[model samples]
Target: MQRKIRFNKAPLLGDDLIYVEQAIKSGLTFGDGTLTREVESILQDQFDDAAGILLTSSCTHALEIIAILLDLNKDDEIIVPSFTFCSTASAFMMQGAKIIFADSEIPTMNIDPQSIENLITPNTKAIVVVHYGGLGCKMEKIMNIAKENNLIVIEDNAHGFFGSMNQKQLGSFGDFSTLSFHGTKNISCGEGGALIVNNDRFLDRARVVREKGTNRFNFKSGKIKKYEWIDLGSSYLMSEISAGILKKQLLNSNKIQMGRKIIWMRYLNALSEWAEENDITLPSKPHNYTHAYHAFHMIFPSFETTKSFLKYMEDLGIEAISHYVPLHNAPIVLQTEKRTKELNLCPNSSIYSDRLVRLPLYYGLELSSVDYVIEKVLSFVVEKQKSKF
Candidate 1:
């Protein structure tokens, strides 16, 4: 029997062990320690326009920090792509904001600027954009809309860390951006994230929120005599061990990204002709944008076809899978009367949610395994087509 290829495995990049050991020996294993500060500094140096960087326990927490910094009020509305992870909207929801779901553009599967504009109302406070599969969203148009409406922009940069559009990094484009270092992401620290603040105005308040509503950061820097509860906040800091691992991953990001890029391109090359012939859709890259090659996905013509393909791959010991369920229509999203009445209103979100399939594209995935997956998928497509005839 052939060995099963898992969907994703946490990458074991060089220096992970070394740095982790160094962090342990340093004896500061808690939050806001040496490794955490080093990670933030490294990120600030790499990404242009970074006003400040705070390491967080997860990307979800990073987003929650943004919500706190914004001081969202009850019933304040936020526009978000319905195709995104639940955390994208949930962060704002936790702050008593109403989530208005927006549709995703077919090309990049990022939030549609037009849909965002349509969803906006006087109550709208912010527009949250997710950069799907490491490809940048239409930032120029989105930013323009945000500016005209005087609404803040937050980037759900979980998939696009270190990726860029038009020579500018994805996370730097928005007022605030969140990065994930979850095991499945391009880089892994098991569970870690960063909040990148582009505007300097929020730097002080952001620190307060990140340090549990206290003046701890100022106190530590000797700007203040001691720490005190100063504002609304949470325990959102990343552990020193996680930060140490992430530091190593951040330093080696380029190499890891290059490896994933090679795999992504190979999949595109192998499947493009087959996909076009079958009326299937492959991932699209817009001009002036560089993807981190975080994930490779295909959209089948129908839900049943996609289901069959996933099942076929599983039978062959390859773990192909689907991405997000349409968050707007999710059971959790619809449970409340107010939420249910709001309606998802995103037909395209449902379209892709049912038909898109994600292939395994991770750091340690072997070429042989990739080839096996490609062969199996192509075979499934061919057989399905023949049966149609």
Candidate 2:
């Protein structure tokens, strides 16, 4: 039988055509077009920040910009969780700062704030937190730690767009928050990102930095007669085509979020009882935090069981799979660190990376497909149990 489900599918609303038609009509297809400006305004309202919003080619670029704005250098240390995408650490590494890997709270699968306190030293410059699976981390504890040390707080909110904590949005909490609009994310423009600058000190410079160190933004707004390179910067601006697609996605954000939430809940309800009986761990839902449900991941008893279960599901035509290999264990990271000794430090990260697998949860997934995936998973677990008896 053909695979009954796909990992993700982008919603193809007429927004792309509208953006294309607008681009052609205006004869402005490059960056700083009308669409880009409109999207910036929309994001400002969406993020609850009236100060600065600069669009970038991707979240990686946004993080890079944050590193530059902070002027991070050698001797500076940035605390990061080992169980996250490489970009979280790489953005700081590019600035010649030392990366101190922290452990995760296995319950929520987010960075442990208590572990962050243990990792900070005199050289520490920032605490980079990733909102794993669109769920908020323990921000109150994190913010308290940063406040005590006067460290910069940068949120790698790549997986969290509409997610919130204490009724406040994730992107608005940190000094600088970066969001991704990659194809896999809830919101997509094929490839794009935005940086929400909460502090005014970085506003003027961020705009120039994103525009390749030019005051071109000021020039376009008639704030300057002629724009020139006034600071060290790179090309991080998104094109009009990308901005147009993203703006369309933004308009449909509510509908998309609601649909994904339903799928996420279905998975939770279907597997909750069996998961508990088998001693399997399910994703935790905190009281004050609202997850955007970007992914539905579960932890199996052992690495071997996870592998066997994945094979069983595949045989039943479901495309369920595993997620990130911890950055600390990756060859590139090891080469950069030039030390294998540090590899054994993150034991919790190692375990989660080994046994966790993600289920397919996306907008527009059929209800029947949801039931089908859960049925297959249940059958696989039951058969596995029988073999031992």
Candidate 3:
């Protein structure tokens, strides 16, 4: 019997056992342990120009801290792509800021720089850019707009660890960048995240915020006699056990990345012609951008066609699924006055929500498994065409 291929799978080596055993022996199972420090150090080293790095419980928490550091007011507005996870906009919304949903470029599924500039107003405080599927956004254009407007740039790089554009890393482009290490992500520690502060001024505040408003981090470093609450914050730190697992994953990142890339390329090569002949659209790779192969998605002709294809694939024991719904249209958006029609955001996002399907591509997934998935998908397309007769 063969194992069924999953849409996304985590690569956890036996090294996690060693780390857990070491953490148990050290007796520092909480957040402020050597393992946590090591994980932060690894992040700093990888993101070289970062002023500092703070580990958080999840990317959502990292985004929340960024909201605090931004000091958003009730009247402030933050522009975001509509085709993203809720955390991208919810973080700012939580700070009482208005969310201005921006349209995404059809080809890359990233925030359109032109639309971003058009949406800027006197009350605009920041622009949140999500590097969708580990593909870098149009940073140069977006950064130039932000600089001209004197607005902060926050990067939602949850899917883009180790992804780069024009030789510069993705996380370094903005004032702050957030990463996720959830089980479903390219990297995993069960549930963890990190904040990369590019500007030195935000580092101290970020540290205090992550440490539950205490100066404990400074106190532990001998910079202060004792730690105490100095500002509004929360407990966003990751446990030592989680950090220990992440350390091992970081060490083996190259192997994991390589395997994922091979799988991604295999799918592209195998399905290119079929995709073209069927009038389906594959993902676009922008110039100067290197993707981490976080996901492999394609657009079908229509929502009905996509649904039909998914059912056909499922019948064949191949589980292909769709990506996010347009957040601007989600019910949660109605709670706030930020109406979906106001921004004229991404008509394409609605199209993607209805028509796109994501296929499986995980590290350590066997070549035979890849072929099986492709075969099933191609067969579905052929059978669906025949059934239309």
Cα-based TM-score, every candidate: 0.97, 0.97, 0.96
Candidate 1, number of clashes? 0
Q: Which ranges in model 3 have alpha carbons more than 4 Å from their true place? A: 1-3, 338-345
lDDT of each: 0.88, 0.87, 0.87
Off by over 4 Å in 2: 341-343
lDDT of 3: 0.87
Clashes of 2: 0
- Worst lDDT run of 10 residues, candidate 1, spans 335-344
lDDT of 3 by residue, 1-389 (tens): 54456787789666566786789899889896898888889888889899989889999999999999988899999999999999999989998999988888876788989889899999999999998888899999999999999999999999888899998999999999999999998889899999999999999999999999999989999999989999989999999889888889988899999998998888888898999999888877766788968888888988888988888776666668898888877788866664555554568787777888889877788889999998877776788668789
Residue pairs in collision within model 3: none
Worst 10 residues of 2 by lDDT: 11-20
Best by lDDT: 1
**What is the number of backbone collisions in each predicted candidate, taken in the order shown?**
0, 0, 0
**What digit string (tens of lDDT, one per residue) describes model 1 on residues 91-196?**
9999988888999999578899999999889999999999999999999999999999999999999999778889898888889999999999998899989999
